[model samples]
Target: MEKFKTLGGSEGSTFFFSVERQKKWERLDGPIGAFVRVMPWRHFGRKNLGYLFAILHGADFFFDFDDDNYIKVDESTGKPVEILPSTTVLDNVMVAMSGPTAFNHHPMMKPSIPAPSWARGFPWEYIKDEATEGEPAFSQSIPFVSKLNSIGVIHEGATNVLVPKHAYSPYNAQASIHTQPALWATLLPTTVPGRVSDIWRSYFAQCIFADSNLRLVFSPPKIEQIRNDHDILADFAAENDLYTKSGKLIDFLSSWDSEHLHFPQRVEQLWIDLYERSYIELDDVVALQKWLEALITMGYKFPELKPRFRNVALMGQFNFADFPNSMTQIMMWSQKMRERFQTTIAAAPLNKTQLAYLETHRIDAIPARDLKLRKRDHLGFYNPLSNLMRTLLRFENSSTIEAVLYAHDDALLNLTELSEGKYPFPTDKIANRIKGELSNAAFVDLRTMPDRAKARTLSHRVFPNGTISDIDKTIFVNTSSELKKQIPSLHAKYKQWGHYYCAPGQQQMAMDPEFAMYLDPDGSAWFPFHTQSDFLIVPTKYAKPFTEAATMHLKHFIWIECAFGKIVDILQQQLQAPTRLVKLCTGFGDRRGRWDVINNHDCQSESVAVFHPFKIRGRFDEFWAHADEINFPAYSSRGKN
Candidate 1:
């Protein structure tokens, strides 16, 4: 039998792509010429092995075939003399195919000379007459176009694509009970109490200051007098742990309702600066209105909560009180990031690129519940959050929801109260894609890989061994009645949870302060393809959108580019070394309403250096130094909301 290495790179490397096979396939039904044959074989009886060969059939074109031995045939008439059984021969030939282009690009040919012993097998053989209507059956042998089946698997001949399972370092963190209801079901309130008279006011108030909504409004002059008398600012300065001090400030500041007292902008700005880490909120209503308008103008709509003229007036003045203290703040930020990222990933297929990263997990567009509710033309408006949430859920439950892709960031604004009860499986067109993947029998779970390798029979039943895909796997973990029901439980338990980093002065740096979603046993569902910047990381979702929008909008381009530069700055700051680089990312916005500096057209190019925080000693140490009672002035509170 003849032997030769297949013409290609290493096995299973999908490099450059082309339409080679389709081009060669133009051969069918045009004319009767020399015929080509392909075959496979079984070695070790069941053990698979084979060799690839080529022979000329029609002039110039090659019939793709391979084997060590040459089988004799009547050359003049192109008739088979003696050879192996067709099935065994076919099997052997199939085993040798490296990829689709292997035969597609080769010159069609015929075998010659005496047959070898290995080629000797039971059964008759002959090349059949060409089909008259369409392409021949051998066309299926081409590869590299279908989805991958397992973690280590790859399409043959592709390069430059990252293999996360093989390339990246592992740094797993358990999902925090504070962030996941499936883990914190026991800790949730049995039922929420009576509703506040003004849910909008309550929600708005909650957004401004975290501890409670009513604290911000003190009507009694006596209470105001006491706030001035007490050494609130001094008390704040006296505290050592900045996190605790910030919490205290948040508790006091969130309770203030300014409509009654009419406190000056300077006072409110103090609290805002300390909590949000920015000083953009000036005293003027027009200034605040301009800022809100700016965000809207930049495509950051306020989603479902359309404001009445009065509501818009209220929102313009509303501030996120101390509740956005770092721990609470970053969690909410992560949630917003999660929502946008998931939507972007799901909506990606609409672009229709040949080599998109989302080919396997294509999802449908979001469904609008209030299709009738276009921007309200009348005087009054409704809260858009509900409609937005419904739309988000509908898209989330869509059948196209690819399990292979998942969000890495935590929730930015988790309103557990809003997330109570079980949510039914969404019944919408989007649900079909997600459901289809979930029902696929070939899905496999890689979460339970054993360090102590054992037989597949007894391992955890999360995913079956030898499974080729994630299409049929258990993708949905939110078993509760409503998606919101999963919120409070997660927040209460995993509020301060995050990925820790060790840097100068800070022994550990907190990347996220909420429970991060992960595969149950411990594995990642998504893979990182590229970074948006030296410090800013962009998974497929952000990467795709940023790339698309950057071409059109200078704002997105500048912001994303600045974010990339900021990432490096952050890394260097954290390491406190010029040599170290920072990793940066966007979770929408911060508590003080600061966007990535790149997005702010008002700021000069140099501001990125200023907005980027310097790495102190360690996470807590730096937090304590920059924050603490010393920096954050305090105010005396009379009571709780």
Candidate 2:
């Protein structure tokens, strides 16, 4: 607002943008003539012009704020209050927040009170934890993302120094900065509802910031808004777009895999996709197109939109018959992965009809053997999983495939966990996460790990008798003769330390150190890998090595989970770097952890990148109801759709 007001006699830059001076913007006969009517009368959408105003006036950076938000004055002292420091320096003491989808800073803005209102454009789906007293649903994890005070409220409070954490933080035109590089986010969609136009702009711009590693900091409220008269109901009505579509918007951005786009290009593609879904207007996208063109015409170079092309092979059993719902699930994932990667569904060719269908849908089918595990013992699941890894590791273009996402056949990955793609399985962003963080050993969920590594289980109560052996007699009793012959050395270790094998409740960090030493009497740095492998990802380069080393004449398996852990453990010794892992989804290491995913699905839906044990075969309707917030699976199968 101050930037525009200062363009008084600066005709050189003023020719392009001259908003009415201290006068009614609604007047058609104002200085800019009927052009004022082109952008709607008395609408918040006009705020986009502020960004244009900044760009035209040679401002490398400009503060984009609203008129209703006033500079907060300290009654005790007649001066501007310092809400944030005016410096950018780094040290161990300095906190850091890297690439939060949305920074819910309102709670930080007013710590004492429960900042319950939603950010103007925050997704309603995530805000499921409602205060039973007729309050709006709020996302439990990202509570502050939606706080209602930004709307016509008289704010009063001091804020704490910012805390560093990843979240969905939406800064508004209310009082936000738009530097030269950040200018692309200031676009206010002309056709957006008056109430949500600014919000739409915020999400649009934040996508670029979040992905590009742009710095977006928060501070105390430097302004007090004494908003003009407004019909509260009308404002609510205008927010319909915000309530329904924000989740999809953020979800799309979060899982956007385009494998080959960056910055404004990705931003443009997002708007295009949203427009196709009728979630947003295309004219707004064009406005952005023109803005970029104008900047380019004036010889203003945009920082290059670096290409983020990542190709990945999704290796898993994609059965559609035993699990009819698997058809729709596979289709959904293939479509989702295409958003972020050049994807290949490397499924076992066991089902010819299924392979034909996948190929017909252009879901580039890659033949990978899904050898079945005949035995039900500790090492039973090793053969088929190892066979699959060996196949994926030897991809035609293994160098091109960045990572392999392995999961249960029923796992449905998406955002917000709503139906209609309100929340689906995650793809692009998660693949990048797997690639960036995973080193030679394998990825693990380090967050839930103890500060110091020791033998532990989900519940400390599930300890075994002091010195027991062959406690897991199943190692020999259920072990098939074929598995024993293939990995006799591994068989010995499995039988020897079978007591320490992890179960639903009896998972060990690495099992007891004595047990570790027992397994590898001659090995050093014998890191016991966690057997939490209902769903997992392995870097493509390590997939073959991991599979090859799974039965390292040592460290056999308890289940497929144990195989995954042991593979990483065996291979880590040969790699140059240590391992790093992340817990992409919520549900993990619980009592009914494998059996009851739906019961806890409500709580774990939003936070995870890859959801597991979704069991679409039986829970199809249930997953749909949970995801789309609908009655059931709208289409019986992908064919029906």
* lDDT computed for candidate 1: 0.19
lDDT for each candidate structure:
0.19, 0.44
Cα TM-score per model:
0.15, 0.45
Positional deviation of 614 in candidate 2, in angstroms?
35
Candidate 2 residues 1-641, lDDT tens each? 33433543465543444455423433424223222334544667776555554554566555556668777677789887753333342112112221223434444344565656545666766453321111111111111212111111111224322222113445566776555565655667777776777777666655554334343444446788898888999988888878777777776655454443444566667778768777667676676666555454434545433222244455555533345455555554443333223343535433677767655444555443333332332233444465456655666346456556665455544422211233112233222122222222234432235532221211111122221112222222222233234334432423423343433212232333433432333221233433445455566666555655553322334455444554554554456325444434334455322435433534343333444555544443344334322111222211211
Count backbone clashes in candidate 1.
Answer: 115
**Tens digit per residue, CA lDDT, model 1, 377-494:** 1111111222222333333333433211111111111111111111111111110001112122111121333422211211111111111112123323222122113233221222
By summed lDDT, the worst window of 10 consecutive residues in model 1 runs over 309-318
In candidate 2 the C-alpha lDDT for residue 21 amounts to: 45
